[model samples]
Target: MRLEKKVIIVTGSCTGIGKAIAKRCVAEGGRVVIHGLEPELGQEVVQELGPANAVLHIEDLATEGVAERLVAVAVKAFGRLDAVVNNAALVLSSNLHTTDLTFFRRMLDVNTLAPFALIKAALPQLKQNRGCVLNIGSVNGWSGEPDLMAYSVSKGALMTLTRNLGDTLHREDGVRVNQINPGWVITENEARRKHEQGLAEDWYKDVPPVFAPSGRILWPAEIAAAAVYWLADESGPISGQIVDLEQYPFIGRNPPKN
Candidate 1:
């Protein structure tokens, strides 16, 4: 019951990592506002977490006023907000040649700008409660693959936002801000993405050593487990940090050429 009676807002929570975090928040005795684009999926998550523990909001993060609405939902339902997990992202494959201005803008809108907007919208409540923020970034933000140019750029901007606000917000408002860059995680969307890319059904099981050093990629539950510490009071005044959650050192690691 680390988060007992606390209220949290988890975006993109209808599925994937966000869903896992929402569930974990409930398991730890916290209330959550589950947000996503799909109404059916959002309703399902609300049902799973139960009406008392969770509420559902279906909308695009890029939409104006949606962030405020989300905050309103949390405050109206649970009375106060303790934490916010910015996990909603638009993951698309685009290279220098394929990424147009609109594509890049959309990427930034959802991945970077939306998080900033939400943070700003929730600032008052967070300040009142002395709550924290957790931004879910990706290891791709470091350099990224060739085909992930726009996505990578968006994440890179988010990393900078996390660092900038983490320091200023923590010092000024006593609200901590931190980010976690997750490696390859086997989520439902990832599985479908691989299949859509022409990989076989069991593609995750045969991942290369360079990608899955532990013989398998990460699990959503594992990320959620690590997330609890940051969200809980146990973290204690730490801010302006980016922790990469990968099996190996992401910055510089030369794998054996077998």
Candidate 2:
């Protein structure tokens, strides 16, 4: 197993890419602490991963002290942390005019501020263990998405946080840090919601599934594999880097430029 004996903390493990990452980490011989708001689903994920491989944390990460609570729990249970994947996110897709301050602030708090607090609390422990950190950024972090202004801004700030922390850790301590920005991945619930909202066409046309030059939609498993690979590998040479899961042409819907 690539990650044998490693202890991994993955937020948002109840569903989607986060769930897949938690499972994959366990399957790769890592022990995981799964975090989410849904107690039942978190327990279900841990159960699905079997006894020794998983545990659960029901946390509203947007709260100020939630990260400290999560870290304390993980350390109390596992004794030490080998890696942390900041995957929990609360998204708000609103234009400037349509968006309210409350909605925007909440998005920033959840998507960006939560990760910052969690990492800060985990830093001393992680530094002691020489552990690594992986931030779940978004394609919106690197590119401009007008529809999701608040979410995009938060993700962008998340990238900045990743870079700043990565640099500090890599230089001062042995800790490594990186960010992963994934493309659109369709889940059953997401599809159903879109269909209900009469936005099926929006999803279908917008999410092209071709990889790299293919412009295809990203699968959750694909992003999970990247997470698995990053933590499981020991070289850990990459710090302060943002790994964009979208291999598609960054400029247009077409293949790579010749």
The local lDDT score (0 to 100) that residue 69 gets in candidate 1 is 98
Clash count of each predicted structure: 0, 8
List the candidates' TM-scores in order.
0.99, 0.90
Error of 1 at 56 (Å): 0.4
Pairs with steric clashes in candidate 1: none
Supply the TM-score for candidate 1: 0.99
lDDT of 2 by residue, 85-185 (tens): 99988755588898898998888889888888888888888889888899998887766578888888889999999999899888898888899888766
User: How far is 249's C-alpha from truth in model 1 (Å)?
Assistant: 1.0
> When superposed on Cα atoms, how far off is each prediction in RMSD?
0.7, 3.1
lDDT for 256 in candidate 1 is 61
**Residues 72-125 of candidate 1: C-alpha lDDT, one tens digit per residue:** 999999899989999999999999999899999999999999999999999999
Residue 150 in model 1: shift from native, Å? Answer: 0.6
Alpha-carbon local distance difference test for all models: 0.94, 0.82
